[model samples]
Target: MTEFALDAPVLVRPYTARRDGDFAVIGDDSRQVYLSIPAEGLDLLEWLRDGATVGEAVRRFEATHAASPDADAFLQALADEGFLAPAGAHDPPPDAEPARARRAGHLEWLSPHAARRLLSRPVLAVCGVVVGVAVAMAVDRPGLVPGPSSLMFHSHFWAYLLVVLGIAVIGVWLHELAHVVGARAAGTSARMTVGNQMYAIVAQTDLSGMWMASKRERFVAVLVGPLVDVIGAALLFITLWLNDVGVLGLPEPVRLVVAGVLFTSFIRLLWQTFLFLRTDFYYLITTALDTRSLMADTGAFLRNLVRRVLRRRLIDQSGVGRGEMRTIRIYAVVWVLGRVVALAVLFTATIPLLWFYLVRVVGFFRGDEMTGQFTWADVLALAMLSFLLDGGGTLMWLRSLRRSSRLRRRAPDRVLVE
Candidate 1:
């Protein structure tokens, strides 16, 4: 049996487990870590904490629980999970110890209930959109006509940004509420958290617990936000149409607010649809593939393949289960094909746009000085620099394409079965 030392004070927290009775190691605010071992494993864990080596711990376990078999294997498994660190390195420095021990408990349950309550019905969601759009129109403009500037001026740019941001926050919260409502309809639970610092907002469904549920349920949950966006867009279009036909006069401020909300809502929907960005679309793709752990496993296998191909030593291969490895192989082939197709399409579409823009900039620069705001030389220089930067980025990404290709060879499958 393999034996490892618990020498480090810091241990890896097990976030996911495949079986019950698995231990969860959590660090405390005071730099002390607690191992929530299974009742059966408690004595062995305690013995190790009491300065016992692996062999001693095993011996103590054998003496205490004679019926327990495979003591050595159990100890090794504990070591692997990082419940025990190597003996000598396990102690934290006295001065630094308290800080290490002070760990905040996971707040997974924090907004689930409120989120559920707020997102329970289709009628309510429809009403929210109607009210949100009505409020936007009422506060901003009477029609599509360009209104007087509504931009607020303040001593601090941050304060102005904050005001605009408040509106954005309301929009985002409504977006999440869409998901919450969808999940509720499908009888699932969801939680929200600050995902990335850029937005300081995120909503996540603990749908991992519902992996075994029907695909229809999963699809409904995934489609909720996009559906909400669609409704919002439709409302905006109707508002615009009404204003154009003179059915109702909208103030300029109200018009601007509605337009802005519509634009942002569409953008949010588009963002979620981009599967490569690992947004809601990514979850949908994964669900379709029926491989719950597709991302983690495929990533591991691809890393291993890259290392092997590049003549580098292989690191952790533990995460890639056999089924995942099979999926990875299939994914790799499909991924390469997809990229080839994408690259071709991007070149065909983007190249012409780039060339047209380049020509415009050149013409703007080279035109007569009297008719032009800027000299030809300045425009030409800026245009050339922009081209060079764009070209450089494209080239860099192209070069990195081979690595991406290798990685994609293990892309998640597009369809999954129940």
Candidate 2:
């Protein structure tokens, strides 16, 4: 790409426009790009579209507003965001393509109107009441609270693993479906796939398109999944309570299966709290803070802080504002502390769990019969469960690095920009 003179005409891509508070949003429905900018930025774009040079637009902006804009910063930002290009540059670079994900587009029948009806105030109120009552009862009945040991209520380990896994699969579908509903209500769509966090397997929903929606809609879309999880858990608890009180006569096996679902849902809720692990809450935080490159900026903040202490060369924060940088400074503490806690859990709990199953399986292979309370069924189930989660998840995590490499090579799934 050849550099052009500042006096040459600029090209602003054709974009649909809307007013969002103090910002003007210009984007296309084709998923080309979306930009949220100050109101005057729209004027700048219009001027450029009318064949004005960068210099002329800058002067016009100052004259109209009685304040000078950051000409270089403004142009650089536009260029980087694919809004502006040099004279006669009609085509984007072959490598500069949008990263498209395969969308299953599940629940196509649930139109925007249907999603709104499902998420209406009445429905939400009923859900809230159910959850509130469930919580009140669980506070009194300590048995309702699930723990790691709650995973095995059945005598047969295979029954336990199978039911728990089936429940988990359904939970993932429901969770991602909630996100899709939220997206539809916000006048868009999303997709879900089996994805992995840095160290664990997960159900990932691509709400990348929701960046164009209002903050309220984005909040609804991201937070609604957890909300649905809570509702599901509440229903499970209430059903169990009914059985306990003899209002319903659920058999032992059926009751235990419901408890497994409750436990999986509980773990899913807890997983969202690890915001540093690229969970939904992380998306909410980034959206709220108006961060374009939060993880990247946080890394830079930590790197520069260490350099300042060591009297070494510092790195640029890459266009982060002072206010945003300050927030990043505070969040950096939370990020580091969260990671430290994760490492502690890994070394203490996770590693031990891995070793426990590994050693037990080895013992059984060395002509050691399954004796005592542990049967061959128990050994097989535990070994397979541990290997699939620990071993398979680690493999997926490694494979995710390759996905990250592909991401770096393609156009970014653009987040919001101030």
Candidate 3:
């Protein structure tokens, strides 16, 4: 802990402090310092705001309240969050208002007013009607949902790759754009970037600024992404059904392209349900429950539990709220189960896929007798898959680690949550 003069007045950096349920939320949005604290913690910030010394604040709090505030711990807590300024400063420090996040500069045109209109109830209702119509059509047609046979685009492989990949890129962009618009509607900033979820590349939005927004607004920010994605995918399905009945009389290649889009879209939606991976739905859960960093806290809880069993120095989680801790404890079980399921699938599917492709490739190089048929195209596909899984995933994971290290250089992940 850094030493502080007990007699000197403490100056707090620019922050917005508000009461939420039984705790106070204090934060500097630009710096991404958000945390929930008990009443005494709020009182301490109030005292410090009025130019109270650490020793003076503690004495005053103990004078009226039954609980005693730890002077050193109090200062350390604030310092941990970068919430403090130089002692006895006449004004808030020059760096109180830091620069905003590295958001998409192109989205400056998307104001809160525009975002609100786009996500308005009327607009949502219209979209809901479109999705409902699509669903009804699907029920009648029943073939709208693409299956395994739909993925066979062998001769039109290049076109399938171009069209499907193009649509996927667009879909991912739109998905992340919804998150940004949602945050903007809440009068907060957001950043969109490419990231990796374990091995697979993913696009994500940094909606940390939503912490300053109200609970209802936070829900909007998180849910908008998945909601828009589902609706857009439904519309694509309807388009394919429209073309199927001689209304459009599209070519087989074109129909195959649409089928490919639908296939991937459905799979993408299913992937979001893997809550252990902290999908958009995970953010929705965290918002609805008003829990701070539930995923991170749950991970820490499991880590400490193992450390405890090993008689090691367990890391402290005392800063987490009691309600949040309860949720974390339950989520810890879900977290473990979810990972087990994911690992089971990886071992079952990924291993077989790897083995099948690898052994055939080695057979070709060795000029050995082939058991099953092999082709250059098959080798090409295998090489691409290997590159994406091995090389691409490794690079992406390293990038994610570097990003986390850069953003969190000043404080621990605990600083953002309760």
Top TM-score hit: 3
lDDT for model 2 comes to: 0.76
Which residue runs does candidate 3 get wrong by more than 4 Å? Answer: 85-106, 351-382, 398-418
lDDT of 1 at 84: 42
Q: Write the per-residue lDDT of candidate 1 for residues 143-249, one digit (tens) a residue.
A: 44222233332233333334444565676766666665555554444544433211112444334333323566677667666666666666775687577668979
Could you give candidate 3's per-residue lDDT for residues 1-418 as a string of tens digits? 5566878787778788777777778878756767677767888888888988877888888886867877686667666557885585454344333434444433757889999999999999998999998899899899678986776665645456657878877987888889889888988778888667766677788877777788899888888887877887788888888897767888878788788887777877887887777788887788788786787778678867887798876657877778788898888888899878766765677657667667777767788664434345556565566656644765786687686566545443332232
Show the lowest summed lDDT stretch of 10 residues, model 3: 409-418
Error of 3 at 302 (Å): 0.8
lDDT of the candidates, in the order given: 0.51, 0.76, 0.74
lDDT of 1: 0.51
- Which residue pairs in candidate 2 have backbone atoms (N, alpha carbon, C) closer than 3 angstroms, thus clashing? none
State every prediction's TM-score relative to the real structure: 0.45, 0.83, 0.85
Off by over 4 Å in 1: 1-3, 6-84, 88-112, 122-228, 240-246, 249-277, 287-293, 299-330, 345-418
Question: By the lDDT metric, which is better: model 1 or model 3?
Answer: 3
Candidate numbers sorted by lDDT from highest down: 2, 3, 1
Candidate 1 positional error at 15, Å: 7.0
